[model samples]
Target chain A: MPRTRIPVVAGWFTEDTAEEGFRLLGTRCSGCRSVHFPREDDHCRNPGCPGGELEEVALSKRGTVWSCTDGRYRPPPPYVSDPAVPWVPYTLVAVELAAERMVVLGQAAPGVGVGDLPVGSVVEVVPGVLEEDPAADTVHTTWHWRPVAVEALS
Target chain B: MSGDVAVLGAGMHPWGKWGRSFVSYGRAAARAALDDAGIGWPEVGSVVGAQTVRGGYPGYVAGATFARALGWQGARVTSVYAACASGAQAINTARAQILAGMADVVLVVGADAAPKGFFAPAGGDRPDDPDWLRFRVLGATNPAYFGLYARRRMALYGDSPDDFALVKVKNAAAGALNAYARYRTPVTAEEVAASAVVADPLRLLDICATSDGAAALVLCGMDFARRRGVADPVRIRAVSTVTPTFPRTVLDLPDIGTDSAVAVEPSPESFRASIARSAYEEAGIGPEDLSLAEVYDLSTALELEWYEDIGLCGPGEGAKLVREGVTALGGRIPVNASGGLASFGEAVPAQAIAQVCELTWQLRGQAGDRQVPGARVGITANQGLFGHGSAVVAVR
Candidate 1:
């Protein structure tokens, strides 16, 4: 049987599904149309506009790579990795969403290293398992960015 | 420029893992500054301390802690925390008080006893804080951000690993000349290239380490300086503590995303550039007038970035400046002449004040070997967590 899937943080991304696909969630201010990732549900961050109600919005699934790097050493907590197991280096990607005109940071898909993508390469967000709590048979899910083919998202 | 304050004295407790309490370092630095100024504890009417979160309760109320350690003198007290920018805020606070006539002579101090290894956010499960969320969610350490910036520079400006290594080489050479620097030995380009990669494009030697250190300054109104029989003193001409404007496009530390520029146009000048610009504008001096600069070199590549931000060179021209030795000692604009965080690591609260101390020395021509010849004007630039801005323009 497949393990139960859980979002590491709720309301930050869409539930994984074949038809709709996984998309990182954000909020758009109705008044100024400003976009915010990690979901700013409280108020619009725009200084000029009178406070507007922030509504739930889905962020652009595809974006161009703004920059990328890898962490070689084990990061200090609250980053949770199985300390019992040897550390595995992970790639971090900052992607620029053209529609939103903002950049969002996420862990690159497994096997995606810094060498795999250039600064302006296009990438797509997808659902992935952040970690597995083997004792509980549950997997924490999160969004990951994967580089796409040159012609795919251009 | 109207209400200039005299840097009557400056001191530091060195930079290293001393295994002592932050209070001790703060008191020692305070005493050193007082001694250098030839002023007693009682003569100081006010004290402002930069906060060190790692130092526990006393660190939070650092002003009282240092005062109590020095014996209570009923001095007005203030404590400020701006992550790495803490010391600048403390100095600004003292300068404000002196200008307001709240105090004739004020003692400003910042010290920290940092934990070993990567600087982590305070422990908790709350997701509200961006600093905590970044580590918990993406495992993005400070070096990760540095790596992104370095890689971006490499892509944008055709900067090579050789250019990055040269920065360490230059700073290490300068640090070797300073007695207070933690890393006193010069580093070679080959050594930097040989170091293990902490974050891609940035080697272990490229990033600064967490250090335990303290720095203090004695600041007073210009009248007080002359009244105290000091003929000439280093005067703080401007303190730029401006915040980032809306639609901040660049990704900053402890943030998950950049502010969207959909509604408004982003500032043409990056936040870092604005920091130095504010100081230069206030001081009525531009980059051409700078004798030396002490910028936060959290990473080797970041130092080069600062060269452009401070307008010493045009954007993407920082590497050329480094390559041409224009930013090295005996050059036209010597940067990080006191060794910088590249040598001092990061004492958090203390580092910015330490930058000022180096400026005071260089401007006063007291800096023994690393002094810039005929140094007259200096600027120190720093940016801390949560949009804290810092820059100090000092003149002899």
Candidate 2:
């Protein structure tokens, strides 16, 4: 099999992209000026907010880590997890973005455990491997927000 | 509170996976309702169809499809798509047409030929879509969200796994007697525990399955019903289809994040509670006046949550009510008289219409075995993805 880096999905963000900036694309209403993330394909969802055409917008690259948890058990069929090996718990992070006004979810970057990150710490997005199927020669890569070192930043 | 409309006829194509097209199921159910109403197709003033995305491309617009299937009769057609809440929206559309004097008699139909397994959003590489993102990103299935709710309930109310299993036991027993239910076998708590875990804290039995089914109803103006010598037919008093207020707090399905309540105080009532409250206000009835209820029991735990949200019990007292057997048969106020989603599974568009069908049967005293005694007032509550609220209040 040819070697390749299989991305979960294209265009939302890219693997091998620089660490200085990483964020998902969303839409903001021009008329009502309300921001919506994971973008609205149609009109503004805010029913009371008059009329506004949704415009493509960029989201916050970094936010404060709000709370975190771990799914110790395996998920259902749609979620790809190997049964042969013992289940490994992955850390789940919830970050609060001030600009868009929503809590975004993402997996923690590699080597970052729930115990390593404190509440209200700053985290930025970085590409990480979600799952690997060695038998099938597939490595699913997704974007994860890492609690970057404070000293690493200016 | 507004001009009343009479439900002239209601019918179903049963609830099971027969592997037929949604159009076939919808057309058959519509024909059965028309036959029950003793009205010909051409005599029907208008038709509204609630759409099922499981219909593939044809689902994009269902009203026209059903109109063509029933033979083009040049009637006013309206198709509504709101995931699970489509059925209630269809009823609301029909009621609007009748109240407006646009159509004296209207037919509303919802049908689905569902696929097996967890329902997924449209296939695409669209990362911007949250529904697609959750599936593609974290592989979070619907049951995972259900599991979260079950876990949260345990944390908040000290609810045990048996409490969740009891919901299945109660609903399954009721489902056993429902000829329209997909699963006819009554379930045991042991069975629920033994069933494979679809999501943590929730086993296969604790969640509903996807099935193929259809339901249809014929509605007419109150004056028309009285003129037809039908003095006391079941009336749809209120149809609440509201969206979530600005800052939604709950973590809903297909969405990875939640609205930050830092900016504004969250509504005292969640989106689901607002649905029932609006219906009660419009119907001029209180929770104390309700005789029975049919809620969206997509998961057994979610059903308990609805008990509190719909005012069947006080906050966090849902488990207590279930333990006391107040929501069971011969209880104070039996819920899910038609066995709910626990029996019917998720048929999307058809489920909401099915809820009303259950209400109609109870109100008419036609539900022989599952009837709640003297069910003169009933309500159905359900919410669809992306803030589609659905509730209907029916009175005899």
Candidate 3:
């Protein structure tokens, strides 16, 4: 049987791979208009704002790299990685969304390394697999940041 | 000065992976503090214990645990948990009691028995927790954030790997002279460069380790000190525990995103700079008055960041300060004179109190070899997860 596809955390990002469909989800406050990544469903976090409804909003698909680094050593659990296989380092990037004026962190897409992304380089959100659990027959889905191609700029 | 609380005694169980229970280390540190104060445990009007999450149940009710370990005489007990800022919160609690006249003398204690590597969040499949989510989603370890900050500095201010290594070299030299430090050998820049990279832009030597350790302080009102026939003593003039204001733009630990600045204007001063600013405001002193400082150096690059955060120098000038040896021993304003977390590693609850302990010793001229000559004023600054700010200003 084929593996089931599920978000590592539900409602954080759309599984849609198309350019218009693939984007990280966040909540914007109706009262204060403050934006929160990871979707604050409870209430507006802005202290000054009188209580308001938080509505899910799709974050900007493209952003500039605020900073980037690679994890050389394996992080301890509950960060899932197979212990049997040799550890492959992953690049993590903090991307700045101009429209929202906020920074969001996500793993770089597979085959992407620190050498590829410089600070202020443009990147876009894409669907990626967080981990695959063979025993569970499930592929945990997550978002990955990929550098925007130079041709895409024009 | 009128709100000053006298620091009668300070003590620590030398930081290391001692393979001992947190209670034992806390008791030993408490006893040493009581002895230094020339008083018995029974005389302490109150006790405050910084919570250690790793020690299980006893770590939660640390105040009662330490008091019970010392054979409780029914002292007012309080336990505070603020991540890395636990120790400072414990001290602040003690100071509040003394200033409020609820207690004549208070004993503050913090201890921890940390695991060997990468500090992990509590286990379980809770998606509600941000700390757990960060690890589960991105595998963003503590050092990874340090690496991001280091790289940011490199990109923004042109700081180099060599500048980061020099921070370790200066701190290790001071740590070598102190008996309480875990790593007592002086380090060189070359040694730091040679160390394996745990996170890109940050090497193994650049980051701190986790260890078992404890620190304690005996505090009382200035009037109480005077009544006890001590005309003058080291005084804790300020204990700043300010939370970050709205629109926190900086990406701090355990968070996958920064607060949006679209609605609110980000504060001109970053959260870290605000931590020290609050302390300076309360203490009525500027950075110029500081003879020495003990800032949290979780990473060698972090030490440089702190130089600017604590107002030791202007923004983007931390690399210049270190390069010119301005923050080194016998320089304009020595930082981490007791070697910081670079030498002591991290004991979570115990670390912030340990910073204050260093300040007390320096203010009293009791620090043996690493003492800053004629040191009269010192500041300790640290930050905790979940919006806990920690800084203490001590003066003689």
Candidate 4:
């Protein structure tokens, strides 16, 4: 039997199995065109514009790396890592989306260390498992930033 | 000209991991400030406190807490929390009260007893809280963000680890002369280099630790100061507790993404720079008038970033300023002469107040060994989590 796949947070990404479907979900304001990640469905955040309908939209998958780092120690809980296993350090990358003109932070793809990417390097969003519960046979899913090849930048 | 609030006195309980309650530290600092001002608790017409999350119920209502601890006398009370900028907001609130004629003399205090290791979000399964979501989803610790800034600086400004180490050396040297600093021993570049890595591209020494500490100040109108035989006291010329402008492009703490700039153009000045600009405009003085500065140095690289944010230099020129020792003690526009968070660690609410306390000492020429000679103007710059931007300009 296939393990259950659960998003760490719901409605943050695309679910369909279409090619190029892996995208971080964000909300765009109908009146002002302001975009918000983690999908703001309730109200438009633009203070100047009166108010507008927020429409869920897929964010650009590729962007240049604004900055990146890795956690060297186990983070305090609420972050679901098993204490029984040795902590595997994970790299975090902040990617700047050109269309939105915002920098989005996410974990780097598994096995991608700080040395693998540099500031201004292009990176794309990919679906990845955030954590796995062995007893429950469930996998918590999340979005990751993967560095694109140097040749792919041009 | 914007009115000024005279800083009659400033005090602090030395910053350290002392196993004590927040009330004790706050009361001690408050008493010290009152004593230094030659005033008693009965003379204080109002009290403002910088709230801390670590302390239970009393921490939230810190003004009343400090009042009750200092023996309540029906003083008007206010408590404020702007994350790390709580102290600045408290000062701003007290200044507003005094300037509004609501109080003749107001006491401002901020204190915190922090937990060990990484500062985590308050416990719960609240999905709506952005702070909790970031930690749970990404495990992005504070140092991780610091590392990102450090790496970006290196890439953009050709700053090396050696340059970052020099910041620690400079701050530690200043801290060594500060009797109130927790880590009074001067550190070398080798010591900073040998420290364990807590985040990639950033070592343990590069980041500040969590500490239990407190700070307080006695603020009064210029009239009150003169009536009390105190003339020409250190005056708080500006207390900037401004919020971020819309379409904030920077990635600040407790947030997963920046505000989208599609709807509106981003500000020409970053949020951090805006904090200082507002303070400078209000103070009627430019960065050139500053004799010294006390900026929040959560990380060595962040201090360099502040050089540009506070208009000490152009963008990306921060590393060059540090390399030239221009921000070191006895140098041009010395930064963090109080030893900074690097030596004091973080006491959350107290940290910003501590910065002002250091300014008070320097401006009064009473800073003992860490004194900036003939210091007249000083500025304290700090940014808290969320949209809070804090900076205070003081002059003798």
Q: Which ten residues in a row have the lowest lDDT in candidate 2 chain B?
A: B257-266
Candidate 1 lands at a TM-score of 0.98
Better of 1 and 2 by lDDT: 1
Estimate candidate 4's alpha-carbon lDDT, on a 0 to 1 scale.
Answer: 0.91
Clashing pairs in 4: none
CA shift of B58, model 4, Å: 2.3
lDDT tens readout by residue for model 1, B88-143 = 99999999999999999999999989899899988778788899899989999999
Better of 2 and 4 by TM-score: 4
In model 1, residue pairs whose N, Cα or C atoms come closer than 3 Å (at least 3 residues apart or on different chains), thus clashing, are none
Better of 1 and 2 by DockQ: 1
Model 3 lDDT at residue B325: 90
Which tens-of-lDDT digit does each residue in B61-149 have in candidate 3?
Answer: 99999999999699999999999999999999999999899999999999998899999998778789898999999999999999999
- B367: Cα error in model 2, Å: 0.5
True contacts kept of each: 0.87, 0.22, 0.80, 0.79
| TM-score against truth, every candidate | 0.98, 0.83, 0.99, 0.98
CAPRI tier for the interface of model 4: high
* Tens-digit lDDT track of model 4 for A78-154: 89898889989999999999998899999999999998879988899998989988799998989989988878766
Candidate 3 is graded, for docking, as high
Per-residue accuracy of model 3 over A1-154 as CA lDDT, tens digit each: 7799999998999875675579999999988889999799987778888778899999999999999999998899989998888999999999999999999999999999988889999999999999998888999999999999989897
In model 2, the Cα lDDT at residue B89 comes to 95
* Model 4, span B10-73: residue lDDT tens: 9899989899998999999999999999988999999999998752697789999999999989
